[model samples]
Target: MKDRRARWYGGCAPGSRPVAAPVGARLLWRDPALWVCGGWQPEQVRTLALGSARIAVLGPCSATEHDLARALSAPELATVARTWAGSHTVVRLTERGRVEVLADVGAASPLYTVRAPDGAVWGSSSLALSSLTGGSVDTGWLAAYLRDKHSPASGLSAWAGVTPVPAGHLLTLGSEGGMTLASWWKPMRRTPHEASTALRHALGEGVRVRVSGVPASTDLAGMDSTTVTLLAAQCGPITGVTVHPAGVTTGGDMEYARALDVPGLIRSPFPLAARHLPFSATDVPLPATDEPAPSTAVWAMFADQLGTVASAGSVCHLTGDGGDNLFSSTPAHLVRLARSGHWARMFGDARDWARLRRQSPRPLLTAALRGNAYRIGRADFGRPKWLAAPVPKVSAPTGPDADMALVAELRTVARSAYAELQLADALGLALHNPYFDGAVLDAVVSAPAEQRYSARRYKPMLADTFADLLPDAHRTRAAKGLMVGDFHLGLRMNRRRVLGLADGRLAALGLVNPAPLRATVHAAALGAETVWPPLLSVLAAEAWLEAVERAPGTEWTRNAPTPAGAP
Candidate 1:
């Protein structure tokens, strides 16, 4: 029986595999029967017993082999047994015919089940079961898919007829084909305050735990080193914390140097000196000086700011252009942009070549605007090129009433755009992070009138949040830092390589005017313009599609997989 079971496990013909059986039980003939077990938690097990009668059990049971043996000794033990531990679910059947099932506390793992017409029951991934049940996949779920990007909890595969066994559920199948399903666990809820306090304590403890082994003392006395140590202590233990010394090539360093040269700009605005360090700039060589150069100093002061602006601009540009191209006046713009060919248009411009050759920032701004322009050809626009709507005026709000309305509108738009951008980021499109969501923008834009007058609070909320981590002078001043524009340098340095790939792909896809895209990219690279955010999104979308094509299997059919034998 054990040998037969092993072979069954190894190579059951795709659709012919037994859905459920007791561990080590041999299938002597082709019969439609399946056993399922799921939902195990600490000190508790949820199981499904199947055979002559199907039943589900939810309670604690010792996992000892002896306990299992004794439990199986009863006459009712002719049924199959399944158990869930952690994320793994296991099934075992006793000689007497009983069945058992098991699962874990968090229930992150999933098992789906379906009963076939011939009385055969099956359980596997939702996708797999859908294939067997002849179910039609649901594309509406794709909306939910866009929201979470992960498989759903309901376990309903995109296919119809297939259903997910709820997270905390167990099911048993009987010889007569009777089936039963039951819940085995329920999550407990805590008050918001309690949850918050617990989270705070956990975060503090986590920091201490991660930094406990580091030397209690260090020779570095500078604020930057101290701030870095503190940040490391807080975030390192959680996972994936990487620390590196600031290098010259980084945008943060360059930006910092520029800021220092401007009149009245001071070093170290935040309290923690190291918070200003630029870590996101790729492979910048550290600046050398008796006292570290102010540029380097500024880098340390604004390290956290280094990666955000470029990322933010990319998202903003994509959302705006994508929204306009698809005529999506709603948040659903990302879906259309991702699906239609416009994603490619946004990134196909070659204006970066021209921008790199210019020392002035104006050309860069022009390139940025042009890259973002939704230039509909005469064929696509259904009119002559001169008939496009005049640029809408973005008039400044005139009074408190107007300001409030404007602020509310901006907040709404920003939030809507942010959610879509986050979805794209989750899907690995390298878009902006959603940190600058509506709430953050609201706070920044609505600072006290007095605070707004100061040049130190440009991004008031962000400035305040890192005030303690930066130098004192920097904390009080407001300035819009131009991070996105700096991409021109990278474009210039790697124009040939980027154009080589971007040009051919744009031509092949026929999604845009290839000549203009080529011109934009080249113009931007030569310092005559800035063509990054819009262009990058298009490139990323193309890459993503190519990646999807290369993925194994039917490539997640736009519709869900159909279940087996279903009409």
Candidate 2:
């Protein structure tokens, strides 16, 4: 009987191999498919048991397996993730066969579960869950997916009826077969110095583990990667790469990458293929599920860069992906001030934010009064008016309106980061991010909101936090490099692909109307606002649906992996 359950864990997807038994989430087979979402990776599974209860820490974790087990066994359930310092997920099994799963606040490791009459099926892979149950596409989810072309604000996956264990929540499966979810990480406000101290410790430690005391290199895009490269060098000198924009895109990344002169600073040709006109899937990753990778064009370049890093004989690479979302928020922090009745600070912060962004304070104050209407894309697709998304369900944050705006932005960032994780796994390389580190996240949220956003002191924070790590010359070189120029080329080349979205699966599902979307593409071809991001996401979804249909087999029988793996 024990062996039978173990077999179930290994073959959740056909052709998947198990790396020994994992405790807790018994239904979650440690297969390759589930590793992509977050936390668990194919080679990073570790398990420990005590008496009857058992625990598994999957992905990058600082605690030794035994120490992690001891922490989970504490009377306070939150202790399980409280002491951990890296991106990971934890699952604990009780004597009664009940299970508990916990993911970090970033939801860096996504956990998707489906309940059946026999038992519950859970894993990190959304596509695997869909295949296991023969699930149909959920139109509401499809609506939301198109709505969130860039990043996902909610924990839900695209597969209908398959539930995502929300980030920072304790998800438990009772022995009798029921489940309960509740928040575990409680963030408290902190003094600026206190927050800085915590970050210094957390960020330094985060980079160290990924480096494993070996020399490392990081992508130098801006302050985020720049700070990380500097921190990694404290332990030992590390190299950096600048994915300089090739083609018509303006500004060079090398000026920034070269300034932080540590050791081997190489200029990699990460051209944002301005040639793939309309929308290039040329060597781009396909979405196997509803993972919203909004910036596909940029990602193609990132994918090429990762391959270069791997070939350079580096074991791990550091990233500052979550930096902006975690550190540099916006005036939205004022919403918390107003909500809490700190009227004086609210007014002051708004005034300061307006000055930094070079806008009038009146607009900032008015926006705070009305609350943030977080708009990622145009409200609806270019419409026959009938092409509409379901009214968005706003999950009012526990604090203030700005929280909604900031959280929404972070969700998109997380989705992009997760997509990059897939690229890393494909290249057999490890990527470390201090911004998403559990400790760094808790510390950032605890800082006074004014310092983070209201004053727009991102550059100052970057300088102050890692002052020792950064080079003196690079301190003042703060201009950002953007790929706005690449978009113009992408829009022209992918005109047909954009047209396909209007006439494709989305139109058939009533998720979009063909006529207006078709016109939008024509207008884009004629050099209007180029292409809309929502339209690009729809094309990404169409590609995924087509890939799913193209698969010759499901979970029951092995399907040949597509270009981006099983859908």
Each model's Cα RMSD? 18.9, 6.8
- Candidate 2 lDDT score relative to the true structure: 0.59
Candidate 2 Cα errors over 4 Å, as ranges: 1-43, 148-155, 213-217, 235-239, 247-251, 263-278, 281-290, 314-316, 337-348, 355-363, 371-386, 392-412, 430-433, 454-456, 551-567
Candidate 2 residue 166 C-alpha distance from true site, Å? 1.0
lDDT of each: 0.31, 0.59
Clash number for candidate 1: 102
The model with the greatest lDDT is 2
Cα lDDT of model 1 by residue, 198-281, tens digit: 322322232232233332211111222222233333432211112223443333323332233222222222122223322223
Score every model by TM-score. 0.31, 0.81
Positional deviation of residue 484's Cα in model 1 after best superposition, in angstroms = 6.2
Q: Using TM-score as the measure, which candidate wins?
A: 2
* Model 1 error, position 138 (Å): 16
Local lDDT at 50 for model 1: 32
Our tally of clashes for model 2 stands at 11
